[model samples]
Target: MANPAGEAARPTILRTPLGRVRGSGSAKSGTHHWWMQRVTSIALLPLTIWFIVALATSAGMTHAEAVAWIGHPFNAVLLLALIGLTFHHAAAGLQVVLEDYAKPEWVKITSVLAVKAVCTLLALAAALAVIRLAV
Candidate 1:
């Protein structure tokens, strides 16, 4: 039906009593998570390219030569950034997937927390390794 102003009336969504009690609900953090995912993805592009080029250029290097390449200040910093962002992106993606598909609430929460912890530890280890190499 058209309203007095001639715009069609919008249909209203019918909710169950329980749903009505719950109201329009959300954790209110989806936007932040989405933005972080996008920002990390953009940051990874250049870092990944740098890694590929560096790897290709160092293809035939001996252990010492490779170590020297990584030990360069710029390379070390970029590598650390790459490692950190890669792990963070993985964790965020995994979290979304688990939240969407995991059936039990406790399972979903536990899986997300486990992913976060593992990613954090891996990133820390990679960063430490890079720092040791640089030093």
Candidate 2:
């Protein structure tokens, strides 16, 4: 649609409880992250629900039985994938939180990176453990 004469599109500024803020271009990087996070979240949703159901249905089993259930190829693979996706999502969220709150530049940078590293390691360790247990 074209604007009427003498009328121009005004920038949409968001008004929040904290204050009024304007949405600006994410500098490209932010848009990429936002997109990836949403994609991963969509993928994780089903996996999470599956995990819950799998656990619920097998809850009465013994420790060995539980282990065996997870040892199945499909279950093991999905579990590892879920762990990885979960960690990635968590890292992204934590980075945003840190960036929003951390005032000191050095502290913000270090904390965000540190949290990312930890989450990555934890995800890798979990995946490896699942693979080992399954195979």
Candidate 3:
């Protein structure tokens, strides 16, 4: 359709994640979030494989033996990395889900905050456990 001047109508641009209908676009932080999720996933791959293999090899390790294994610098460091990346990735992914589906704006914001807080606390606890074991 043409306006009063007989010019063609403007093409409709794609809506953003929040469904904005104007020139408004990403808040500029999405790229960082996207990059972090990608980076964490890539880093988690090797860490997860190492963890699984290490666990498989030590299948029957007793409590003390497991503790001793964690006491090793190599094992402790890898375990810490695994915990950190896993939780970081988890929070990022959950935030995306919340942003996409949560109906109420306040609810979405609150849920995201809670998810991040819980993930952060869990990650810290896991790291602390690893450090305690290593000590």
| Cα shift from native, residue 125, model 3 (Å) | 0.5
Evaluate all candidate structures by whole-model CA lDDT and list the values in order: 0.91, 0.86, 0.93
In the range 26-94, model 1's lDDT, one tens digit per residue, is 557859989999999999999999899878876789989888887999999999999999999999999
Clashing pairs in 2: none
Root-mean-square deviation of Cα positions for candidate 1 versus the true structure, in angstroms? 5.5
Model 2 scores worst on lDDT over the 10 consecutive residues at 17-26
Q: Judged by lDDT against the true structure, how good is candidate 3?
A: 0.93
Candidate 1's TM-score: 0.76
Task: List where candidate 3 sits over 4 angstroms from the true fold.
Answer: 1-5, 8-28
Q: Is candidate 1 or candidate 2 better by lDDT?
A: 1
- Model 1: residues with Cα > 4 Å off, grouped in runs: 1-30
Each candidate's root-mean-square deviation in Å? 5.5, 8.5, 5.3
User: Residue by residue across 25-89, what tens digits does model 2's lDDT show?
Assistant: 33557488888889999999999999998888776798788778778898898998899899999
Expressed as tens digits, the lDDT of each residue in 1-135 for candidate 3 is 789999998887667745574657667885899999999999999999999999998899998898899889999999999999999999999999999999799999999999999999999999999999887
RMSD of 3: 5.3
Candidate 3: pairs in clash: none
